[model samples]
Target chain A: MERLILRVTTKLLFAPIILFALYVQFHGDYGPGGGFQAGVIFAVAFILHAFCYGLDETKKAVPQKALTVAMVIGLLFYVGTGVATMLLGANLLGYDSIDPDSTHHAGQHYGILLVEWGVGMCVASTMMTIFYHFTGREPDINQEDW
Target chain B: MSAFEVELTPIVFLDLSLLTMLILVAFAMLRSRHLFAVVMLSGIYSLLSAAFFVSLDAVDVAFTEAAVGAGVSTVLMLAGMLLTARREKPKTPGRAPVALAVVFVTGAALAYATIDMPAFGDPDAPANSYVGQQYVDETPNDIAVPNIVTAVLASYRGFDTMGETMVIFTAGVAVMLLLGLGSARGGREVSDAEPEDGEAK
Candidate 1:
């Protein structure tokens, strides 16, 4: 009975968290919400699920190795955007110099989108990774500190 | 300027609420015995401060505070607590004297500074006449981003953003080194192996 109750409450908590994350992501351009907040909110839902259903299940849902890779990839994406701008004869992240057209509004949009995606991915993965570390069963591996 | 003149503005009420919430959260944080409760109250304080910043037209600061201060700091502190004690140590005589001296000096300095400062949101203040106007007027042409904060962070003040990113990266690296990547897994295994001798009681 307790397990059933936990499952139902977990579902209830998850629904609003997911909805709010999506709202934050889309409304970032016009309002207070943004990629970072959206990412954290999304991760919080999953972390709550891990608390309710146990860390093993959460690990299966989001493997730690994959999260590390996601973090690196997200940061690379952000830096790559800046590098691309430099390659196109612009100063670092100077969107206006991207194309022959003096006013590269489209380039600016694309650059911002890439950076925002990177920020979102890094934020989400790092949060989940922290949750995993805190909640997961420790392995038998010995370290210098121990 | 008539005697019967009345003014109604929601901003006045919101400012009062904001101030009240901030003070309440600050009090709760200081009074709480549980470290976790104090951290939660601090997060609430950060959110309230962000709201106040937004009301004062410092939207960029509000965004950063809401994200880094409230969200990220709370999560990191909670993670830190998992590796440490949940309750604060009992107060000591040594700490009381040092804390009181620090508070007295800081409060006096702050009071002195406030006397010379412009009123909140003063239109004629140097802050209003200086970079704020430039940001408002030239930002559209300079960065082409609709949100001035985003433009400033990503372009006008790109170096600072880069520094911030490096700081975050350093924090991640430091945590990984200090805790060691395998500590979490190891801790769990020991917990799992513990005997269930007290189950019946």
Candidate 2:
């Protein structure tokens, strides 16, 4: 747990993983990666931090309030985008009404980006929350028994 | 040789290789007594299956499988394992045969059902017709996305993905409700004195 290599590696890898997750989230229209994968990748960075530094430390970095907020806001954002389009006189989630500009294509682009961001946020937070729950538990026995 | 034949040969070979590795990993997973080994084998099986998806040109699916299957799920499984016993109980002989028979019958039935399906990469296949053709042709004009899959998933099938996002949200809420996520309000306290597993119920 006190190894310098793992500690340094996790610290170094965290930012890059988040950056890649963002890239995947935004670039889904052009590539193989998307929100779900990006979200998991983002969660992996946090999980790696937990593994190297311990759960309590990670929990301190990402508190309970923030985790819950992230999870809720992500879904809300996705649904909110859809509702905004509905308010603009299009069907629910129809991207055409999202932009005031004449071209619907640009609206679609922006709409997809927003939704993917929502997905990425939800997934990353959910994964991290699950990891927190699993690691948060106190083992019935000693750590070495496993 | 024709272009199709040249491409098909290597893909078929790769598929067979990946499938072989998949089977081997599944067997190893079944045979392993150590739970850690089983988890690792399952991760390997996911990687092999992801490779198979790649050979089929389902890059998005392969990306998901590699990330969620081999990456997140494996870590979650290990974390779950840490909360429980490391070694599985030996299967009783009485229950083993019935399980094997059930598995065998199910596998045989599924394999038989595959016979009615169209051949792989058949352009005229039902899956490649109608909706699939429409998505491919219409996505560029309608959504203007380079990746049709993204266009369809994010726009054409937006409602479905909204449902999926909700499902994930529900899962997070459920985990919080069950395990408390190290929170004290409307959840169990995380102090050392309380029984950890008891909080779940």
Candidate 3:
């Protein structure tokens, strides 16, 4: 795509989309958005890039191996947090154990934030990986034939 | 004249209009032969449903529906369509009737079930009287989060959310395994060879 307009616009919109996704990821604690939506939004920015530039370019930027690893990392992060809390002397997935020295409020807040981050990471990577697989399929037939 | 009636009136109208539009879209999508049109209509349907969610004050749900249903799902459908036929293959003779019967029966059953549900905004409803009330009332002091929904989802029900995340991860892996990874080289070279520039509208 040699079109100057699309190339420039995609470049301009790319950063802001990721930034907004991060904001939605963190601000979900107080607002209407959360990890799931934020993750999809983040993936959409990359999908837009794929639309504008090309699938191969997008894949280069976000490799399949990396996405798969990130997906596992997110799940592990969530499970690890729970296990850590358990080891700290509370029930599984208990936030109160995260800060045993004081009240549970602060622990709950931090635990929620960490858990949301894990959700966000898993969701974003999964969405992108799915998109990549779908778009990367072999073109067995001509576009016009369909 | 009552405050409750005033609040309910607009919501009733909104729900009716949104449902009407949703039905119309569904009918159009069903009748359409072109897969592209079907996908676009589905996206529109999703957006309209998201609007309905917003009206119900479930902004988190609205956001997810808009992003996942309207945005990502549409693109995925389009990509899938590229691999297959643009026009839907003709349905079998008896399939439509069976599907219609199934849909009608399911819809009827669901509507009938709604009759036993507590009225909207009923404070005494079992749903409200259970953990829902506790989550709402205690979220501020317990979690210090302004968004009770987030507190419930991430902290109160963290185990459930972790399972959901794992489910999604499994889905991604499943898709990857079913479809072998394609070429790593970007499509830029192919596009450069063609005279036509592929610019997204």
- Fnat per candidate, as a fraction, reads 0.11, 0.86, 0.90
DockQ of 1: 0.28
Off by over 4 Å in 3: A141-146, B1-8, B92-107, B182-201
lDDT of model 2 at residue A57? 91
Best by lDDT: 2
TM-score of chain B of each: 0.75, 0.84, 0.79
Q: Write the per-residue lDDT of candidate 3 for residues B1-201, one digit (tens) a residue.
A: 112222458787988899999999999998998999999999999999999999888999999999999999999999998888789877765557888999999999999999777777666778778888888888877778899889888888888898899899889888877875533333234333445567552
Cα deviation of B120 in candidate 3 (Å)? Answer: 3.4
On TM-score, the leading prediction is 2
Candidate 2's C-alpha lDDT? 0.88
Order the numbered candidates by TM-score, best leading.
2, 3, 1
Clash total of candidate 3: 1
Model 1, span B43-116: residue lDDT tens: 99999999998887777578768876887678767766766667887776455778899999999999999967
lDDT of 1 at B159: 51
The global C-alpha lDDT for each of the candidates, from Candidate 1 onward, is 0.71, 0.88, 0.86
- List ranges where model 2 is wrong by over 4 Å: A141-146, B1-8, B94-101, B181-201
**What is candidate 1's CAPRI-style docking category based on DockQ?**
acceptable
Query: What pairs collide in candidate 2?
Result: none
Between candidates 1 and 3, name the one with more favorable lDDT: 3
Q: Output the better candidate (1/2) by TM-score.
A: 2
Best by DockQ: 2
Give the TM-scores of the predictions, in the order they appear. Answer: 0.78, 0.90, 0.86
